[model samples]
Target: MLLTDTHTHQYYETDPIKREELMQRCLDNGISRLFLPNVDSASIELVMSQVKVYPQYCFAMLGLHPCDVKENWQDELNTINAAIPQHKIYAIGEIGIDLYWDKTTLDNQVKAFKTQINWAKKLKLPIVIHCRDAFEEVYKVLLEEQDEDLRGIFHCFTGTLEQAQKVIELGFYLGIGGVVTYKNSGLDKIVQQIDLKHIVLETDSPYLTPVPYRGKKNESSYLLYVAEKVADLHQTSVENVAAITTENSKIVFGV
Candidate 1:
């Protein structure tokens, strides 16, 4: 079974030895493909370094994360925009409205979101969104910007069935992460109700670690546990889950 982690920050581990161990664990668990999304200008190098080491296993994406939309947000975008052409990127993201951390940056977050959406359109690439407690606000911008060219995954999606349908209608896939494994996350119900074609898998590693390891740090290797949980929810085999979700990742990343 070949598993894919559509969204992960495994590159954040700067220690070379630990990084290799992390990659080895992922490979051993059949988690072969990992897409890394950089949050700001500072993380660009880290993302690329991981991609460089495991070029065949890792993919890179660029964007300004909503939570990082501070006063110098413009400069951050400028740097990321300039860096885009220098490397090949599968998507422009981990970008979207994040009102959970600070509602005050909503305006800038929206503006940054739209800007990155345009970037994805222009580049003819998909986007990977990071919506947090601001689905309505993010959905509004997506509606305004909806078109044939706008397509991507709603990363870390934990919304209702209606919201999931809305996103699918817009030609975007729902990115299911470790949250689905949570006993009370409610995501498993929504995921079980939805078809696998409109869904993708992710770990958001170093963050939303899956069950049996929820309280500890997350890694791409743990994606196997998530695949198992999803398989259980959908009443399918882990191999089937891995196949469908990996194919979905290929569809989105075009890799």
Candidate 2:
């Protein structure tokens, strides 16, 4: 069973000496591919470099994260726009509202999110959403700005069943991650009702590490933990989870 980690910052702080070792560990554990989501202009080069180093195993997505939204948001978007043709980006992602951290730039975040959505539509690429504590706000913008041709995954989705349905109705797959393995997480409840084909696997590493690895650094190798937890939730096998989610990923990422 070849598993795909559709969303992970494997390139985040990736060191030359340990990069191969870390990625090999993931490969050995069934993770055949890892997609790195861009955060801003600052991290694009590092992400691009990592993709070059392991072109066969690594794929990169370009976008300015909502948290990075600020006064020069347009300038940041311009950088992402220019980078699009340079790299074969898998998607435009890790982009959307992040009201959990800061609200000072809420308006700017919406504008940036909408603008980026337009770019994604124009480029004919899927998107990876990063909604947090702003589902309603995110939904509002998605309803208003998302083009009919646009589609993708909602990364790190921890919302209610209703919210999941809403995203699904909008034509996005739920990006299940480490949060699914949490003891008190309600994601498992909502996920039990959703079709496996509408789900995709992710790590969002080096963050949201699953149980047993919670409070520790996350990696692509730990994706098995999340897959196992989801399988258990669905009363299925890890291989089944991997197969279905990998297929779901291919639909969204085309890779």
Among these predictions, the greatest lDDT belongs to: 1
Estimate, for each residue in 127-239, the C-alpha lDDT of model 2 and write its tens digit: 88999999999999888876677799899999999999999999999999999988788888988888898899999989999988999999999999999988998899999
Q: What is the C-alpha lDDT of each candidate?
A: 0.94, 0.91
Model 1 regions more than 4 Å off = none
Kindly list the per-residue Cα lDDT of model 1 for residues 33-61, writing each as its tens digit: 99999999999999999999999999999
TM-scores for every predicted model: 0.99, 0.98
Worst 10 residues of 2 by lDDT: 141-150
Model 1: weakest 10-residue lDDT segment is 193-202
Error of 2 at 162 (Å): 0.5
